[model samples]
Target: MNKIFAKQFNKRALAFGWGMVMAMIIFMSTAWFAFTTTNQKISAEITSLSILEDYYKEQDRLIAYSETSSKLALSQSFYQLAKDSAIDITNSCKVINNVMVWNNNCHPNADFVKQKFLEYYDTNFNSFMLEYPNKMDITYTNVLENTTLISRASPVTFSSEKQGTFAKYNFTYNFEPSIKINLTEQGISLEDFESIYNKILECNKKIECFQKINLENWDISTESQGSWFLFKLKTKKPFIFYENDIENYAPIELNFIIEL
Candidate 1:
């Protein structure tokens, strides 16, 4: 009886020790990820938003390319780009949100969208086309920003497989996503950025244009809370005189996703 009791005690002690070690490891990892994650996210958002300019140019090119070709061919190109982009952004958001929640919301940027955002993607979004390996499909402008979606579409099929009668597709393309804001570079805290991100869904629900966020005939109300703003764009055609109309001035027509 004495020996059995001692063995049981020893086992308990060992398990407890391992549990403590694992706890420490997790704490350490969370701490390290928290360190300057804000700065890292800031850098990531900047790089992503900056890429939208190139995307707009690409959109123009796509439009022009479609005019010369059949709509079916044009649509294939668009679907390829959209599918590739959406999956990429969804993946990036998932990873970022994971890191953020794990790190206690260090710095919620444009990428760190709604809490249910990733959950929605997991339920609704599918990988573009998994025929090509991820490597041949992506190019990284910022290596540090290479969290997966950070790598732009390379669109190359390296290898493919064929079964007895059927061949499985194996290419990767994440439908891209990036939102553009024409507002001036104002001094907003990390919390403010987080607040606007959270409220975007709330405000966007009523406005289809803002929901798609085409940034047309719209102006963001700079009032109250100082942390959040009401972004409004006229939906009707009968020209109502607003202070800052979408047509009065144009900064840049940027394309971005609202997670849906």
Candidate 2:
């Protein structure tokens, strides 16, 4: 009986030891699984952050490029040439109108009128060409139909309560002229033109700057003049003579009319 009891006790102790060993193995396996899962999650988050950083960096580069392109386009020689030409034409028209009305006293002779117009053209047009020598294929056409004259009146205040009216002698004679601008030999390519136009649009934020302008109702032919574009503009505006405040107000509503 004693031997049998001893054997039963040893068997129970072995079974308990085996159960503890199994429990320890299970706990270690669970801890290892949890650690691996957490590590993988951290690695995935780090990778995602890296991807986002790269994306934003690329976006910044693109934005910088876009801005640079826009600025370059606005500063292009072609754009400057167009703007300067327009300003010159407008100023020349105003000068000629003033000369015809004030200098000749509205009774300009044929020779006087022709000479004044020629002088104004030579001075301004020549200056423009000299500045932009690369721009070739310039054609000028002057059409004289019936001279259309414009007149205006100014209100005169007599006293503190009474109002008076006086006639201010001002006139604008209408003339149609066709102008052609060519850039075929300016070392400019179609791709460059397109890029410049695109950049202009981006900077201006509107299509108005790129739209076609007509000074008067004249037939404009761009292709016939070997120009990239051609248009007819009417030269007309009010001529005002101010002796005292000549710089304050000289010519009003002067339009040199340009088509491009």
Candidate 3:
């Protein structure tokens, strides 16, 4: 009886030990699963935050560019020249093809204006172009319909002590922008998208000739913010009026605003 009782007790002990081990294993597995799930959630959140931060930075940059471009347009001496009919043309052509060259806005290029200036003016276009190569492509065309000249009256003073004078100048043409959006590409991040968008807006604002901007409709389902994405932007710039002939005659100036 004693031996039987001892053997029964041993069996019970063994079963209990097995049960405990199983319980431990189940607990450990549950803990591990919970840890893994939490980790993944944290990682995803981090990624999203990073993307948002990048997007903000890109937007800031674009705004800065816009402001700078606007200010440059306003302060340019060419604005003065455009207002004055006597200085509107370089070689008697209705269009001023090379204001960038004279204003040192662009680099020298193999264009008719450069050739003509070098041949007739006996000046090296390369020097001006070298200093301002990027500025050369800036050009303007007729801004108004059936109007040969536009005038702007700006306050001017010959000397600090002298009374200020108002000068009237005529501009025959203005620079307009033509924007087009290309949607041939694939996925892009939110940051990049915002960057491109802001740039388009800024350019439109700075270029007085831009009349409208057209964009393809965005699909809400696929347009979510992500890295390595693509979109489209398009704009049309039409000369509406001479800068000088703007309804408000005041100092030509540009205002720049940056939002982060």
Candidate 4:
């Protein structure tokens, strides 16, 4: 009896030991799976945030580029229009007084030249604006009289030939005639500037791109390169987005007679 009882107790103890070992194996497997799943989740979240960061940076870059490009296009149009008006005034003067005169202006010429230019400014600018509504969007505003400058050629006297030979020939000449016209004013209409600005800002996601185009925001100057007009249009953007700000500028050089 004593031997049978000891064998039975030993069998029960072995079964209990096997059961504990199986339970331990299951617990370890479950713990490892939970750890791996948690790690994967963390990695996925990191990747998603990185992608978002890159997207925002690209958006900001695109916003700046669009603004710069649009302003440049508009500035070139303005330069061409103004330059053409000035050139037309210059083209009207070919003085018939004394062919030997280098700069002749005795035909009552330059006064009418300004008047003709005013007419061209009104007609051509209106036509151009009407044709390219989305490109430049500028209207024919009144020219600033105070800013308009006209430099007319003074009337020249006949330079007669003193060489008293060869049947005493008489001739006339005009050499390299020129006139200077300088016009200074805010060319873009303030009322119409908002629509133009909004068009430029359409590429931005959330960065505040609305800027008021006041005189204080502009620094414009025109330099003459021979007969061409070089316009430098500048503006400062006073918005800050976490230490990223780009200065916008457009430099346009246009020869009056050329299509550029």
Candidate 5:
């Protein structure tokens, strides 16, 4: 009886040991599978986040390039327009008596020139809008009397002094064949200027021409440079995303002086 009892107890103990070993193996397999799945999910999320970061970086780079390119294009176009207008105005002058003259005056008609400039600018602006669809505005100002006239006269040296000798060169003063009528008041209309200019041109061939022009309100002077006009161009336009304040998101503008 003692021997049978020992054998049974040994068999029971052996069976219980095997059951515990199988349970441990199952638990270890489940834990390892859960850890691997969690690790893979976390790695996938990290990769997705990295891709998003790269996409945003690329977008920022493209936006910066676009803004820089747009500003350069607008600046070039605006300057070219102003330059063309000035050149056209200068071309209207004719050389008379070694000086440039416009309609018997030292400069072109300011009002007329401004009108033509506006017309040409407006026409070209229609085409410019096709490339850059922005509400652009331009302000132009001109000083007609500030124009420089081109002359054909060479520099003349009249006198020179040395250590022991003083020499005087005989130079003939070739007066300009044209006369300029200066009015002090700025209230004169363009018509008044045209009429006065015609009268002055007509008087150049007559003796005692001062009496003919009725110089009670006008002054007389010789024709010279600084009687023409120069203009300024100012252009402004809004940004693509102007609703919010961003760096360099202010209104774009270009300003320049246009000289003929």
Candidate 6:
């Protein structure tokens, strides 16, 4: 009986040791799996943050480019309006003592030009801004005898895809645009000066020219000598008004200086 009891105790001890070894192996495996999962989660979070940063950088660049382009567009629009107003005001002028006088019975002055410019802008250009949904502030200033127009466009925003859902990442741009319009006129070569001169002489020299001569395209000045007069005619230079092309246009001064 004593021998049997000792053998049973030895078997019980061996089985307990094996069970402990198995438990240790399971615990080690569980710990290793948990560590690996935690590492993967950390790596994924880091990669996502990196991607988000890159996306924001790209958005910043895009917004900057857009702002530049918007300024250019606004400047171009202002230039067009100024050119149109100048041409219209200049075209409607009459020549008195070799000087051009506008329809408002005034010579070339900044205040008058500014008044007409504002009138033209209010009448014509407001339609263009209606296409954009954002509010824009446009104002005119004359500081130190300089004609300028300022345009302020509201901030424009762009959102990212799924990545921006939680972080709320977005890009926005605001543009401050202003243009100086000098009330200056450039001289251009007259293509039909000879024809115009001939026509003026033909009309003036005619006897009983009771009919009003069609000098619609020209502004006229006269020098009188004892009931006989010589006609001095000038042509209104045409402006090629285009929105995108600012430089391509006819000059505004001394298109024709012909006397008959």
lDDT of 3: 0.32
What TM-score, to 2 decimals, does candidate 5 have? 0.34
* Residue 146 error, candidate 5, Å: 33
Please give, for residues 116-135, the per-residue lDDT of candidate 4 as tens digits.
Answer: 44454455434433443234
Model 3 bad stretches (over 4 Å): 74-260
C-alpha lDDT score of every prediction, in listed order: 0.34, 0.34, 0.32, 0.37, 0.38, 0.44
Q: Candidate 5 lDDT, tens digit per residue, 1-260?
A: 99999999999999999999999999999999898877766665565566556545544543344344333333333333333322234555454333333343233355754455345434443343345333222222212242211112222222222221222222222111111212123112223334544564575534346233453323433322243322221223323222233333333321111112
| Cα lDDT tens digits for candidate 3, 65-177 | 43333223322322232232112244443222221112212212224322332232112222222344233342222111121111111221111121112222221222223
> What ranges in model 1 sit over 4 Å off?
43-260
Model 4 pairs whose backbones collide: 98-173, 99-172, 99-173, 100-173
Off by over 4 Å in 4: 84-187, 190-260
Clashing pairs in 5: 147-228
Candidate 2 at 221: error in angstroms? 29
Query: What's the TM-score of each model vs. the native?
Result: 0.18, 0.31, 0.32, 0.35, 0.34, 0.39
User: Best by TM-score, which number?
Assistant: 6
Query: What total of clashing residue pairs does each candidate reach?
Result: 22, 0, 20, 4, 1, 0
Q: Rank the candidates by TM-score, best first.
A: 6, 4, 5, 3, 2, 1
RMSD of 4: 30.1
Preferred candidate (lDDT higher): 1 or 4:
4
On residues 147-202, what C-alpha lDDT tens digit does candidate 1 reach at each position?
A: 12111233422232222212232322233322121112211111333443455555
**Top lDDT model:** 6
Q: What is the per-residue lDDT of model 2 for residues 127-201, given as tens digits with 9 covering 90 to 100?
A: 433343233233332222223111111221111121112222222222222222222222222232223333333
Better TM-score candidate (1, 5): 5
